[model samples]
Target: MIQHKTLIIGYGSPIRGDDAIGPLAADALAAGPLPAGVNVISRHILTAELVEDILGADRVIFLDATVDGEPGEVRVRSLAPDASAMSTMAHFLDPRELLAWSQTLYQHEPEAYLVSAAGAFFEYSNYTLTPAAAAALEPMIERVRELIATN
Candidate 1:
């Protein structure tokens, strides 16, 4: 059997309202019919410590919330390492930079994709998801299902 070990990095602050979508995506994926041999992981942010985790994976997917689109919009796209995309993030690392790091540090590169749900209303102290973000869940998870089904 061909085993596809996929590492899912879902990062966002759970307490930061709509920012919680990333970790929530991890949960939705875990609860769904994810293919066997695929491994799921979640985090509040992608930091320096996840380098080794990325190195060992055959493929990787990143789940997060974005403000770059209309509320309730979901974006799914394949990602490649680009130096111009790198950022000096204080709490999180860009998915592109993560790919760049794995290649630079270990000469190991894996296919990467990003699934981002656009959200609005990131209210403070609101752990509950807003209606728009909640509406985005199904669409986001649907894309995730399709991404994982690919060899």
Candidate 2:
């Protein structure tokens, strides 16, 4: 029973094979039976419009699919708003840049975390996760649940 406000943004493209992991994970979390106020969103990317939502939350978790590990590897790390990090493009923002924007523009700095899964493929495909990515879901879900529990 987490009383703190929490927001989870799952970003990735459904057509991009292993990238479908984020949205799928988001959907799973959204349907969970947890007793907490968890706002879940699935997006193709992050943008400035998300700042307001970030401002309203006590904590923010950004879930992204990456190529930084084995197909289903999961990494969760704390985030700080980097003073020098700024968006070169108005439309998209990585987690760090978005945190920096929230701190600088809105004068708010919610505790932030990035929970990412390594992706095996990014080519066009139907809404399907690669075998390794699929196997990764249970662990990812457990990790998310543990985060809320311990936070």
Candidate 3:
């Protein structure tokens, strides 16, 4: 029997206060026990190189910080490849853009989800999360775990 591969990528700016939640959550997950065929990666940013890694997985989960909702809000949303979801920055690529690259190059795209935590502050700080973001971290991680278990 073939084991399904699930890749969890947590990416954000480590120095940008609550923006560090993604990598922090990834690190927390990595330091614990996980089921077989599951891999966790903590990245400072998402880039073109990740498309190769993403292509190898059957499912992918992206964890990040968002400012669109109330502070400490945790949201889980499905993701799809959108060629139009281009990033203005040349260094970091959006998760959707990476998916699009995999689809264009390999003709296959894994099921993807984005688990985001609403952050109150994104100012310059060294891996520190604001009160709201810190409180939402566990929920974000739990949501990812539930996703892994259910789908």
For residues 82-141, write the lDDT of model 2, one tens digit per residue: 856666775788788888888889889988888888888899866788898998877787
Alpha-carbon lDDT, every model: 0.85, 0.83, 0.91
Clashing pairs in 2: none
Name the candidate that leads on TM-score. 3
Worst 10 residues of 3 by lDDT: 121-130
Q: Which stretches of candidate 2 lie over 4 Å from their true place?
A: 86-89
lDDT at residue 7 of model 1 (Cα atoms): 87
Query: Candidate 1 residues 7-117, lDDT tens each?
Result: 888888898889999889898888767777677888988887788898878889899999899988999888997656766654567888878888888887898999999
In the order shown, the candidates' Cα RMSDs to the true structure are 1.6, 1.8, 1.3
In candidate 1, how many Å is residue 44 off?
0.7
Give per-model TM-scores.
0.91, 0.91, 0.96
lDDT of 1: 0.85
Error of 1 at 119 (Å): 0.3
lDDT of 1 at 12: 86
Backbone collision count in every prediction?
0, 0, 0
